[model samples]
Target: MQYQAPVDDMMFLVKDVFSLTERLGDIADFADFDEDLYAAILEEAGKFATGVLQPINRSGDEEGCQYNDGVVTTPKGFKEAYQAYVEGGWQSITADPNYGGQGLPKALHVLIEEMFYSANTSFCLYGSLTGGATQLLQAHADEATKQKYLPNLISGQWSGSMCLTEAHAGSDLGLLKTKAEPNDDGSYSLEGSKIFITGGEHDMAENIIHLVLARLPDAPAGPKGISLFLVPKFMVNDDGSLGERNGIECGSIEHKMGIKASSTCVMNMDDAKGWLIGPPHQGLRCMFTMMNLERLSIGIQGIGLGEMAFQQADAYARDRLQGRANDGEAPAALIKHGDVQRMLNTMESFNKAGRALGVWLGSYLDETFHSKDQSKVKTADIMSAWLTPIAKAYFTDAGYETCTIGQQVFGGHGYVREWGMEQHVRDCRIAQIYEGTNGIQALDLIGRKLIGSKGEYLKVFLSEVNSDLVTMPDSAHKNQVSELLTELEQLSETIISRSASNSEIPQLVACDYLHYVALVTYSYLWLKMEVAAQGKLDQQSAFFFKRILTRTLGLKASIESEL
Candidate 1:
């Protein structure tokens, strides 16, 4: 299936629904950018995604990556594709200008990322990790570390990996056993093995910088004692020249169910020379800077694949002949079937709302970083934190479902690899498992963000929802969303109150509570899109209101039953 970037839909959200350009204009850094520039960027990004990335996706998947001795070779055309990506200056879109970056608004960057992901998710993973690493180093790395590493990282001359998971320790960082002993020269020697490390040992860049989590010798136990390190594949001299090889080596690469082209390496760091990123014994705090960004990017992976699935399904439905419609004598296309239309509509609603929610979160991220107002920065930070897990968990869950539905549309054809539908289903499956399982995301939402904040974050979210609600005209769609919001607000209070008496209440109901929140949030976004469309998207909006928004009712019931 040919992947096309939905540039028009994206423009509508940025220019109309979200008004991203106008909102970011208040920030001096993004004030000069206009809708025209955003359009041009999306157009060019779409070209790269279609012409360069999409063609290689199937071939890459079939060939996969090869690991021989200590070297990991990416699938054919990956190196050249990555080079074109770097040469086009795509890597520096939202990086710090001080570090050889373009310093563009992240709101715009999110849209471009969606296109890349839709075109080729495995290919996009290589660059996405680097983006997250640069963000982390920019936030926590010291002046010397920043100057030494940021330029190459931001410019895509080098890549990065997040080495957090060990064989025994997956979600629980407190159980990590990697050790980091300080050297006499102010560097540290890291000795440990990390598994499921994406882009850990790729040949796409000149160097691979690993942001690893390890415990210091003199520190206490568990997560708190863990520290972040910048361990490079090769050492650098005083004049920024490459020196002797470091001790880090790729033990092997995983033959994964999907994203096979993206090397998932098992890295062994034997006395690897490294520099500390932030203050000692505060690694998790520092690593969250990268992990949170990665979580959001992973969410976009869902939206991208969902879009691809929908396009393929839609095209197939139009071409594939099936039973006659109603009383027709001759056979008709599958698109004539009501059930197929429902499936297609479901995918469309999820993709559209997921994309909008992603861009909404992206605007907040841009504000968090670029807004000069301290008050705005704090609020944006709170809002982004509250929405991150929702975007990650809900988007992936919905994306996976959308892919399956798309596969169903193809029937037996989907089961076979000939149609490429099954590949999407397999590729999207990992999004939920990695980046903190959706269940873990739910726990973080209910346990940490909601209850931990004493419901302060919930109030911030509802305040914006209510503000938007009042401005919207009174209609059935508006009324349904408003009613759902009220239910959500009341349900949240019930959960908070009940949690005072029971500690396990959060975990018991976390998943359902998250789904409830996501449904309501999507309903709200659909209303905004309805208003923004001015009748253009009326049919899609109606389908969402009548079909998709009703899922919240069962979710509310499940949460109440748990209580």
Candidate 2:
């Protein structure tokens, strides 16, 4: 299967659907970006994603990454593909201009990212994780560290990895056993092991920067004692050249279900020289900066794979002819069948809605980080805090569902290894599992986001949705969108009230609550998308009717019954 970047759809969402250029025109940082520049950047990125990286997606999945001794080798073409990514400056698209980056808007970055993920999920991780580390260093690392490390990562000269999980600790970072001992020269020496560390060791970049989580000897117990450390695989000399290999080593890489070309290593750190990035005993909070971004990236990854799978299935359905149509036409294409239409429609709906939501959130991130308006910035922060988990879980869940549907479109061929649909289904499954499981996301939604703040954040979000509803002209879709918002508010009240006494009610209903919220939010976007379309009818009505809005009643029943 050949992968083509859906630049038109993305451009539609960027220029027309979102009107991002007009919205950001007042922000000095973003004022210079025009449609022509956005198009040129997107065109080049599409070329790299489609022409360079995508060609190796299937081949890389088949060959996987090789591990010999402690060294990890990516698939044959991955290193070169990544090098091209660096040379083209794709890795630094949204990086700070002070550090060799183009300083582009993150919304544009998200669009380019989808192409990378859709074209090749495994190859995208090497840069994505590095970008996460670079973002963290830019935010918290001292001027010295920033000057030394940020440029390399921003330039893609060296890749970056975050080491947080240990054998004993997965989601619960407070229980991690990694130890960090303070040295005389104001650095820390970390000694412990980390598991499931993505890009922990790879042959693509010159050096690997590991942003690790460890506890100082005198540090208190639990998450409060945790501190983040900058541990590099190879130490840097005073002259900015590579020094001796550091204590960190890749013990082995896991044989995984998918994304095999990306290295997931068991990292052993023995007296690894590490420097503290943020304040002591604040590792978890510091990591959250990266964590929040990763959640969004992973969500985009989900949609990207979904988008890819949909393309493959659509192509296969249109080309592959088999049974007769219901109208007695012989040898009809699979696309003519109603069931096939349903499947394709469902996937397309997910892709459009998912892309819109991701870009919307990315725009908010731009506001949160760059905008001068304090009120807007505060609202963006809270909105991001509540929606991060939802975006993380909902997008991944949608991705997995869409991929499976695409696979099913192939019937027997989907089960076989003939096409790329099966691989997408497998690769997308991990998004929901890692970066905190979807279940964890649900827990966060109800426990922390809903219950912790006494529903103030949820109320703020509801008001935001309500504000959007006012501009939308009166129609069934608009009415339904309003009603769903109210119903969700009432349902949230029920969950909050019931959980006050039952305690287990939140857990029992968190997943459903998450889904209910996801449907409502997505429908809100569909309404805006409709407005963006000037109320014209198209395939989007298919998704709005069946996939999202129609589910409102059933969700109401489920949520109320749970309460």
Pick by lDDT: which candidate is best?
1
C-alpha TM-score for every candidate = 0.99, 0.98
Off by over 4 Å in 1: 327-329
Off by over 4 Å in 2: 535-537
lDDT of 1 at 414: 96
Clashing pairs in 2: none
Clashes of 2: 0
**Candidate 2, TM-score vs. the true structure?**
0.98
lDDT of 2: 0.88
Candidate 2, residues 1-563: lDDT per residue as tens digits? 77788888788888987888986776778988898898888888888888998999889999998999999999989888888888988889888888898888888898898999999999998888988898889888989999888888999999999899999888999899999999999999999999999999989999999999999988888989999999999998767899999999999999999999889999999889999989999988989889889988999999999999999999999999989989888799999898898889888887888898888888888888788999988888888888889889999999999999998999989988878778998899999998899999999999999999889989989988898789777888788878888888888887888889899888888888888888889888887888777746455764666665677677668767867
Q: lDDT value for candidate 1? A: 0.93
Worst 10 residues of 2 by lDDT: 535-544
Tens digits of per-residue lDDT for model 1 on 37-121?
9999999999999999999999999999999999999999999999999999999999999889998888888899999999999
Worst 10 residues of 1 by lDDT: 323-332
Clash totals for all models, in order?
0, 0
